[model samples]
Target chain A: MPKIVNHEERREQLAEAVWRIIRREGLEGVSVRSVAEEAGMSLGSLRHYFDSQSALLAFSMQLVAERIKKRIQSLPQDGDPRENIEALIGQIVPLDEDRLAESQIWIAFSTFALTEPELRPLSREIHDSLRDVFRNIFETLAQSQLLKPGLDTELEAKRFHALVDGLLVHGVIASEVVLAEEIAGIVARHLDSLLVP
Target chain B: MPKIVNHEERREQLAEAVWRIIRREGLEGVSVRSVAEEAGMSLGSLRHYFDSQSALLAFSMQLVAERIKKRIQSLPQDGDPRENIEALIGQIVPLDEDRLAESQIWIAFSTFALTEPELRPLSREIHDSLRDVFRNIFETLAQSQLLKPGLDTELEAKRFHALVDGLLVHGVIASEVVLAEEIAGIVARHLDSLLVP
Candidate 1:
């Protein structure tokens, strides 16, 4: 065999380049040629990694999900349900410059997915996973009797999920009006209202 | 003398063609050539109204806003404040087939506008006007002494606006799970919680 380049490391490097292009120039700028240039690699090498444009986009989208999952996983295990939930929700919001760029890219991808059939299944899977994360958190609160008695868990789960998604979208658009700190405060207040008396 | 086509009607006809193309083939399908074909007019004739693609898109976007304003103006005045608000909110949601089609076009345009700087100002203006409509309704309720005494009108306004936007985004993606009726129920409950004691 010729000199063996680490494929996984190379893929990570390409995905990071994809993120950078998306951050700097929006999704429309993320072609294979552009990404290859951004990664300081030959087009052939990038093609060897991703095969096609859809494959590259799909992989990039999955990378975003993985980063979010990793961030949530890295949170300390303090064992406080509310703290955990808050931390998890906080990760999705645009609290800093990096996350804000990611949010913009995420929103752009979700929109493009609506018309592009190849991306729809992945989008659906990511959405289901997010809803499940919220559902599990709500279930934990219910088990701990943290949620108000007689609370409709399913409906509350949907509402809470909507609240986070809503906050992220508005924050992406009108950051001046809906800052990350304010979003956290709103989340805290909403959660406090739902807690057991 | 040449026959004079009604300017207002011709504009509406052109916008309708744009809407059809957006719904049937997505925003990327919307080009001067495609829209002219869809409208059964030559590109030269279409040029008489819109000098450029950006101008065409801006006018199409504004037409959607105008339609919404007209719908709101037509709602009967016999309903109570709660009913009026619900009805107003209902108009924005994809309750029926026609509104659902319009929503698909509306969302696609919003995504396109995000990347197109020329269209950004018009998008911002439309969004501000939409928010003002919501703000005025909330202000009405507060002024009429129908809302809770200590309610933060601005916070509630933004929250409600976010809730509606959240529902629309999710509705486009996961409408089967997050039904429109459920969103209406959530809105109703959120409003009921703030009703004056």
Candidate 2:
């Protein structure tokens, strides 16, 4: 039998290699050559999958987004709304090793996207999707009568989004100061403040 | 007579060149040679001011921190506590062109610092200083009897710090979505929530 390769699996493996390099050396260190070397593949073979460095980076970032989306989708939604929401956010923030790595890759990609116009669309899409997540959380709270009456859900959604993102940034950059426990506590406190007293 | 050159002024000029390059081309475009060309100076002359690229980047980052600190210090201290706090935060977020530039440079440098060990201290110093800024805001509110009763100022400080930073990141990365007015409004609303109602 001839050798067979699963293209999607191979691409994911290459993306994981990109993530490892990003975590260890920052996005600036990411290039097609370096990624191919890290993935233990020849440069020509890597090119067959991703024609350019920009395409490779976009795929890596997209994979991060997809993983978070899949995790959130698989989460149990039948439990307490607050706990469910926390669980959803837990997958986004850097609470554990896997999440910590994801957050690092995210920040690295986000900062790089600021200057790379070709990468900006993926960054914007992720931003919009995250905003929807926050919006849906507020909607769920309002539908369940968990939100305080007369609160502007739109503005509150924006605030909640900003707060979570800020926590992610702080958690990644100054994990020593803003510990994981503190991040969870802050989220819980914010959630409590939203509910009827 | 020989022309006189102000050493400090010249260095600031070079730093400004670095800032322009960062804003235009991102940090990846920054190099001693590139910066020298951007500043209309010989590479040898630029090296006289900054012996290495690392030294140049450090000084540029330090200049940003100092500018922010100077701006904060110059703000009038005698004012309504809420407004004072708002004004203090105004200097930190991307509310204006100068601040937007500062924030871009900051995000770029902060992401770069993640894998650059030599730059970590400066990043940490800025993080600590920003934390102190938030801590003092809450303390000031408490002393003035403006804070809501029974609120945990320590945790609130961290939350407030994270929120403003989150706002800053959104403002820089998604200015069209977040908007300047939205950033200001979010800060005002957060302050209102902190006060006696």
Candidate 3:
């Protein structure tokens, strides 16, 4: 009998190779040949998954987004709004090696997006989607009557988004100086500032 | 009499060319020949100013930090403390064309720093120095009795730095969505949050 090849699994394996290349050699090191070597697969085999470097990078970037989305979707939905919110947002911040790598690659892709017209929209989508998520969080708090009286939801949402991005960047770049617990603590405190006081 | 060449001016011109290339083409487009052509100079002339592509890139990156440092240094030291802080931080954010270019290059250089071992220290230095600057800002606030009573200067300093960086990244990446004024507003509110109410 012929061996069974799972296409989705192979694609993920190729994407992981891309991440490893990014982690080890930066985005510039992710040519087809390099990724193929990193994946321990032949170039021809890798080509079956991604036709070009750009396609590979785009897929890899998408995979990072999907992974975060999946994690967020899988979070416990026990309906403690505050805890749910915190747990959901925490997945995006670089709390551990896996997340730090994701954050680093996100930054790399974002930087690359600034110059690459084709990738610009993808970067914008991620930024805007994250902002929307924060907006919904604010809306949820407001609906539950937990937000501060007379607080503007729009501005507060933007502030929350900015705070999240800031904390994530600090956590990733200066992890030695700013521990993940500090980031979480800040988030908790900032969230407190939003509630009725 | 021989034409007096201003070496500093020429180097600045070349760095501008490097910036244009980065803005127009991408980091990968930067080469000695390309920069020489962009700067309207001979390859040998450009080589005299920058011995190699890496040297040119390093200097260009250094020039960006120097530019921001110069801007911060030139801000009036006579304004109110809060206003002074706002204005000083504003110079680093991308409020206009020149600053936008600086911010964009800063991002590119930072991402490039991820895998470039030599550039890594420069990136770390900027991160640490920014943290120190924020620390000083918090110290200034504390000395003036402007900060919330018993606030942790170290943590607040880190938070302040993270806020500034987050605003900058947001301003650059999603300028259409997050305006400079919103960033300023957020900063003002955050500063207010840290003050005794």
Candidate 4:
């Protein structure tokens, strides 16, 4: 009998290989051949999954987004709105090793997408979706009567989005300076500032 | 008689070429030879200044930081603390074409620095300096008797730093969504939140 290969699983394995290369050598070091070599697979087999470097990079970037989304989706939503929102953000920032690797991959892809037109759509989609996530968080606070009266939810949403992204960058790049606890504190302080005192 | 070349001016020209290449093709396209070609100089001549690719990148990144520092230093200090702080931040975020280019170059270099150990010190230095700039802004507000009473200036400084850096990233990556005007507005709102109301 012929061996069975799970195509989806194989693609994910290749994407993980791309992540390892990105984490070790930066996005600039990522190429189809390098990724194939990293994955311990032949070029032909890797090409069967990702026909080109751009396709591989896009998939790798997409996987990072999906993992974060899945984690956020699986979080318990029965807690206080504040804690729920905090829990949601905790998954976004690089608070641990896995998240740190994800954050690094995201930043690398984001920088790459700036000049690679082919990758911009996915990058923009991720950016838009994250923006919506922030907006919904504010809406949830307002619905729960936790937000300050007369606050502009839209503007607050944008500010909060920027704050979290900035923390993400600082957490990944300047982890030594901005510790994990400090990132959480900053997020809590930001959330508190938007609520009724 | 032999023609004279201004070494400092020539180095700046080469750095500008690196910026143009980075803006156009991303940092992945930046090599000493590529920069030499972009600058319309021979590799032999380019090597007279930068001994290696790492040296070239480090200098280019340093130039970006220095340019921003110079702009901030030249801003008039005699205005209202709020406006002064806003103007100072204006020099940091990508509010215009020149700044937008600088931001893109900075982001590219920063992402490149992640896997380049030789480039980490300059990246860390720039990060530390920017954090200090935010700290000084809060101190200015406190000295001017404009800060909100009982606010933790340290935490507020970190929050403000994150917010502005976030705005910078958004202004560069999602210029279409965030817009220049929105970045300015976010900074103003953040500053307002820290001041006496």
DockQ of each: 0.55, 0.85, 0.65, 0.89
Residue B41 Cα positional deviation in candidate 2, in Å, after optimal superposition: 1.3
Per-residue CA lDDT of model 1 for A33-65, tens digit only, reads: 999999999998899999877788889889888
Interface RMSD, Å, model 3 = 1.4
Residue pairs with backbone atoms closer than 3 Å in model 4 (clashes): none
Per-residue error (Å), model 4, residue B139? 1.1
The lDDT of each candidate is 0.81, 0.91, 0.85, 0.90
Q: List the residue pairs that clash in candidate 3.
A: none
* Clash pairs detected, candidate 1: none
| Cα lDDT tens digits for candidate 3, A71-180 | 99999987788889899988999888999999988888888878787788888999998888988888889999988888889888887887788888777666677788
lDDT per residue (tens digit) for residues B1-197 in model 3: 99999999989999999999998877878999999999999998888988887788888988988988998999998988889998988888877878878877877887887788777777788888888889999889999898878677987787677777888889888877777788888888887778776
Compare the candidates by DockQ and give the number of the best one: 4
Interface RMSD of 4: 0.6
Kindly report the fnat of each predicted structure, to 2 decimals.
Answer: 0.38, 0.71, 0.56, 0.83
> Residue-wise lDDT of candidate 1 within B68-158, one digit each (tens)?
8889889986878889999998888777666676667666666667667788677667667777877898899988999977777777777
Model 1 residue A13 lDDT score: 93
lDDT of 4 by residue, B1-197 (tens): 99999999999999999888888898888899999999999999999999998899899888999999999999999887788888999999999989999888888888888998998888989999999998898887888889988888899989998898888889878878788899998888887777887
Sort all candidates by DockQ, best to worst: 4, 2, 3, 1
Better of 1 and 4 by DockQ: 4
* Candidate 2 deviant stretches above 4 angstroms: none
- Compared with the true structure, the alpha-carbon lDDT of candidate 2 equals 0.91
